[model samples]
Target: MNPVIPRLARLFLIAFAGVVALIVVVQIVWINPGKRCEEAGNWWDWRGRACARPVLISDITGRVIDTPEARAAAKDHAASQKAAASKAAPEAVKP
Candidate 1:
């Protein structure tokens, strides 16, 4: 009975080590996706290409409605949203 316990423990340890080694090997070989897509300022498509979100399809298409004025308006709207958020949550700074 005493010898059986040690043999079982040894088998369990070997199996655990094998699993750990497999995990390390997989991590070394893993290729991270979406780095190129981030650089291109778009989402990573399945074909490894950068693609605009469906909601922004019209903007990407350069439609007549998407003019410089519209872009400026969008920028101004974003700035106002940020300002409002900051005002709502004033951070407490310790100097």
Candidate 2:
């Protein structure tokens, strides 16, 4: 009887721990979807209005859209990807 009780306790603890871990994972997946821009080696997920990171589809010379409808009509039709590349130009920073 003692052996059976110990085995049952162990099983119960394992199952409980699994449930808690699952909950945490679900929270993380749902919280952040698009984290590619914020951090490298990660992908973006724009689902259900959940964004793990922001997407800079265009250069950093635009306005900040703060509405729920984050659709940009200008960024998609741009011809200056090199503009953003020039942001790292050390020559311009000389004082």
Q: Which candidate is the best by TM-score?
A: 1
Residues 1-95, candidate 2: write the lDDT tens digits. Answer: 57999999999999999999998886666544434333654455646543344457444657766654454544443435556657757777888
Which candidate ranks first by lDDT, i.e. highest?
1
Estimate the lDDT of model 2: 0.63
RMSD of each: 7.6, 12.5
Give per-residue CA lDDT, model 1, range 1-95, as digits (tens): 68999999999999999999998865544323355545666565645443554355456777654588998987898799989888867554433
Q: What Cα-based lDDT does every candidate model obtain?
A: 0.69, 0.63
TM-score of each: 0.38, 0.35
Clashes of each: 0, 5
Global fold similarity of model 1 (TM-score): 0.38
Query: Model 1 segments beyond 4 Å from truth?
Result: 25-31, 34-56, 64-66, 76-95
